[model samples]
Target: MAIYFYGCVTMDGYLADSQHRIDWLHQVGSVEDTGYDDFYKKMNVTIMGKRTFEEIQNLPDVEKFYQATENYVFTHEKELKVKNYQAVEENVLDFISKIDKDKNVFVIGGNSLIAPLLDADLFDHLIIQIAPVILGKGIPLFTQSEFQRFYHLDQVRQFGQFAELVFSRKAPLDLPIS
Candidate 1:
């Protein structure tokens, strides 16, 4: 019941800069101490893409996520509206398998929707919150899928000094089929 993949990366991995500006996370310091408002109060569902939901719809009190959560917008563009919008634009893995798998989805990103959900492995965890500053290039936080994925690093919370890393997705070994 956890299909996570939160964000923030930049030690050299890049998550935005060469025009995909994030403004350095509000010039670094106090994203509510990086708990992100307690991870949006333990999210109930949030998936983005369509340029990170139009960069959170050009934030400036975008009604603060319409109070609490529930927003999926993958987009292929077709009058993409937003009230508390929902327009996946057809079969993104069957619109993420019809959501509501007991809630707690969250895939938030813009690498073309995390490159087809990490090549259909369908994610599990990848909290990530490095952010130190180093954009030798930009808009890259995993998206060239050739499939060699294997994570399993669990937690590592550091805060203010940054370092959140938390991965998990290493299963599928009994080699002999291809």
Candidate 2:
């Protein structure tokens, strides 16, 4: 499966403010103005943390927002309010490994969720849209990890006030046999 991460971060590389609010993202531009719609169309499934799910549950017609994809929310809660989303309590890596290989999985948010996957080098593509604003202190997109993973810049595009950077995991080098 191709695991993808698509989200907006501040120039300083923060996903949200200190309060874990994405209000800054709305102030800069709307989702319609960005390439989100096009990117969302290709995904077959979505995975997100409880906080990320809660953040979006307040939206209008939230039930239908991700109707197209099989949504999985990693939470300790016994049940989820949304019938469409399945509540998962297992390890993110283990849970993701069970998904069909042909599916396109989109990771919504939560640095906690992304960090482990990134560290394990399971993320296939990262599409980060860099917003112009910079919040000095906030929840950063990347946290300290032991190992480093490399990616190649696939493409760059401007979406109004946001600059989208598309990166794909670098392929392993084929060494010559002596």
Candidate 3:
């Protein structure tokens, strides 16, 4: 499972505004530098929380929005009907484990999903689109994680209201024999 993250963060590192809103995303101009369009093309399966999936539904051209690939949603109650979507109640790891690791898996979310993968050491890279707004208070794009490690910055690009940051997890340090 080649885990990757795709989403944006505020200037202050928050994912959404105080109301848990991300209306600014719609106003973002078309900039290929973000690599979002390309990322979508490479992904075979998408995983997201119900709330995040619902937000996508509210956007215009919902069907066309996710026409790129299959979707696997992790939700408890809501049932969504999409030709390429399957809802799973199991933990993210469990669901992720079921998929063939030979293909790339895109973990799409506001934070809930990102935090888990980061904690479990499952992600291979992160694609962060940082919006130029400081949401002093809101759901942060990266919730405080307990794990402490490093990520090598791969690339950076500036767009209209967002800057794209690509990072790959650093190699684990080799411990000396005690």
- lDDT (Cα, tens digit) per residue for candidate 3, span 1-178: 5888888877888767777677766565544646678788888888988778777776566777667777888888556765456788888877788889788888888577777777788888888888777667888877747767577889998766678889887777632334
Q: What is the lDDT of residue 84 in candidate 3?
A: 59
Residue pair clashes in candidate 2: none
TM-score of 2: 0.95
Q: Which candidate is the best by lDDT?
A: 2
Alpha carbon lDDT of each predicted model: 0.76, 0.92, 0.76
Q: Comparing candidate 2 with candidate 3, which one achieves the higher lDDT?
A: 2
Q: Estimate each model's TM-score.
A: 0.31, 0.95, 0.88
> What's the lDDT for candidate 1?
0.76
Q: How many clashing residue pairs are found in candidate 1?
A: 0
lDDT of 1 at 153: 84
Candidate 2 lDDT, 111-169, residue by residue in tens: 98999898888999999999999999999998749785778899999999999999998
Stretches > 4 Å off in candidate 1: 1-6, 9-24, 27-48, 56-73, 79-88, 94-121, 124-127, 130-151, 154-160, 172-178
- Pairs clashing within candidate 1: none
Q: How far does residue 2 in candidate 2 sit from its true spot (Å)?
A: 0.3
